[model samples]
Target: MTSARIALVTGANQGLGRGLVEGLAARLGPDDLVLLTGRNAERVAGAVAHVAADPATRSRVAGRVLDVTDADAVARLAAELHDQYGGVDFVVSNASAMLTPDRSQSAQADDFIDVANGGALAVLRSFAPVLRAGGRLLVVASSLGTLGHLDPRLQPLFDGASLDEVEKAVESWRTALHTGTAEELGWPRWINVPSKVAQVAAVRAVAAERRDTDLPADRLIACVCPGLIDTALSRPWFTDFSGAQTPAQAATAVLDLLLTERVDPATYGELVRFGRVLDWHDGTPPQLPDGLLVN
Candidate 1:
């Protein structure tokens, strides 16, 4: 018999998170289990039932309550998975916080610190070590976070830097924002750009740390931009949904990347879209069509 193929998705009660659960449900083997997690138990169970209602995924999906912001909870989940299954085969950090409706400075700052940085950072700290040999760690991020967005001086902060350094830079951004010096400090007015860049940098930093270990080649890990999807996260920012892909459509693309048997070394720790590793270093597409969700 084959080993149980275990996979987990964070913040999967709705939107792209739910779509990813359905996509994984359709692809996982009979013996495999895909855990869809959310902060609320009821919501997560509902999502699991809804996805499992489909005959193709009827027996393959389950739900768990996990609030990624709580480092203790994340650590416990990691320990539980390691003890129960020896480790996970695939994990996607998809539960990210977005700017709130009011879009107040404090709210945006909360999103950045709590969900974007704290949440993603916690997941990586806990799960990266518990990933099964040759497993995959896919961080859900936006193309807007690429290094190219930062001024040339700030770009070096992420390139080959340690996790501490990346985190320090993130803290510096927060400090600047609170002091109203963010713009003068070269931080973009659209804070998500810096938030995402730091988030992805943390991923790369973790991967680099793992490489120094004597452990046999570690898991396949990278940040993936799920493209412009018509979801709660993007709908508010964009007036047009015509150009956006359905959550399921975008989810399929991400699933394809996760389930691939082999990926080029260059793609590791890079920002990818639909299996294509993006040129995140210096930026690209000299010019982009206005109001389009190309990423």
Candidate 2:
């Protein structure tokens, strides 16, 4: 018999997370294992029970209460995975907390940092160890994280942006929108480019690190732009997207990238947007830079 592929998905109890859990569970055979994780024990139990009730998926899915923010706990879980399952073939970091409440109000510098640490980097460190050789690590990131795409464009929105010119451009755009003259200037209310770009970079960085090492086996990491799914983090404008894909659609897209074997090494760390894979460049995807590891 073929060895069962073992997968672990964080924030797997609801919305996009739950959608991914169900989609993946459906694709894999009964022998395969998919661990559904959440912070709430009751929620986790419910998620597990729901999966377990389905005859085709019941035997393959299990539940675990995991908080990705806790470094120690994350490390311990990684070790546990190593011991119990030997290694994990897929690790999806889908947990994220938005600071819009703070952003719109008295959100302090610490709050933004908290999102980066707790919501972004923390998740990366947590699953670093459990990833099997040739394993795939997928990080669910926002379009806001893309540096060149948004930071420079919206200086006012972001107190400290990396790209000054881009920030200024964004500030100008923001001002135009507020003055009831957005139609004259023609600008969209929402910007998703930055987050999408940043997500790709983060995933690529991890994949690049794993590729350059002298390890005996190969591994891949890539970020997926889930389009727009209906979730708590979603903004009101998201409803307007006529054909906006649902959480299930996003989950399927993610799984498609994860299951595909023909992805070139050069494209490993790049962003896969709109079902098309592309590299990081200014405005458009760039060609692979030399001396930069692509494998």
Candidate 3:
């Protein structure tokens, strides 16, 4: 008998992460396994129970405690997957930290760069070796982080012809933020936008790196935007917003990318929003009501 396909999702206790796990559990083959991971053990356990409650998905769902920002924790998980399952077939880097109004500029920068950007990189880096050939990697990003929000001068760097250049561009933004020159450097003051931008760029870089190496040509690595879901992270702005989507609705978009029978190479490094490939590079910035969302 063939071994079961394995999928791992970070921050799977609640919100979009939970929805993604649930959707996968319901749709994946009966022999497949879905590992729902979170930073809190109790929360992860509860989420596992919730997903496992359904008889159809019960045997395929399990939970793990993982803090994506912690290198040791990530390494441990990767090692376990290697030993027990050979490798994972799908990895979803869904964990993220958002900036709150009370945070100082420095604090916000740390949360965005260190927590959000850094955490996603850690997940991808540590798990890369353990990702099965022809596997798929999905990084959850935001539309707010599109290059359209950046100054034209900086756009070239993020959209550079090579991964190395994109990495340098992301570093430049971080340096500007640390030195209090972000505004002068033409970076948005909003923490989420740049952080998500960096993530989207990182996806491109990873795909490029793998393409130039021995990894399978069919490996799918891409960033996806859930598009303003009404979750804890977006509650402040989403409560009064008319266009907010339920977490389940957002999860369907991600699930389609992960479980589809055919993998489209064109989407390997693009940001997909609402089932469409958003031209974030040249698209117009989204405008929301004042105070409805912070910059």
Task: Specify the highest-TM-score model's number.
Answer: 1
User: lDDT of each prediction vs. the true structure?
Assistant: 0.80, 0.59, 0.76
Instruction: Give per-residue CA lDDT, model 3, range 1-295, as digits (tens).
Output: 2388899999889999999998888888888999999888999999999888977573388898888878778988888888898988888999977655444545556656765677777777778777777678888988766788666766777674454565566677878877888877777666566677778877777777775442344667788988888887776444476887888888998998887666776676778886677775755435533452222
RMSD of each: 3.8, 9.9, 2.9
Clashes of 3: 1
Q: Between prediction 1 and prediction 2, which has the larger TM-score?
A: 1
Please give the ranking of all candidate structures by TM-score, highest first, separated by commas: 1, 3, 2
Candidate 2 residues 29-69, lDDT tens each?
77788899887899999988877776656338888888775
lDDT of 1 by residue, 261-291 (tens): 7655777877888888877685621232234
Model 3 misplaced regions, further than 4 Å: 55-59, 161-172, 212-217, 284-295
Candidate numbers, best lDDT first, in rank order: 1, 3, 2
lDDT of 1: 0.80
* Alpha-carbon runs more than 4 Å astray in model 1: 100-102, 211-218, 284-295
Candidate 2: deviation at residue 87, Å? 1.2
lDDT value, residue 251 of candidate 1: 94
TM-score of every model?
0.90, 0.71, 0.87
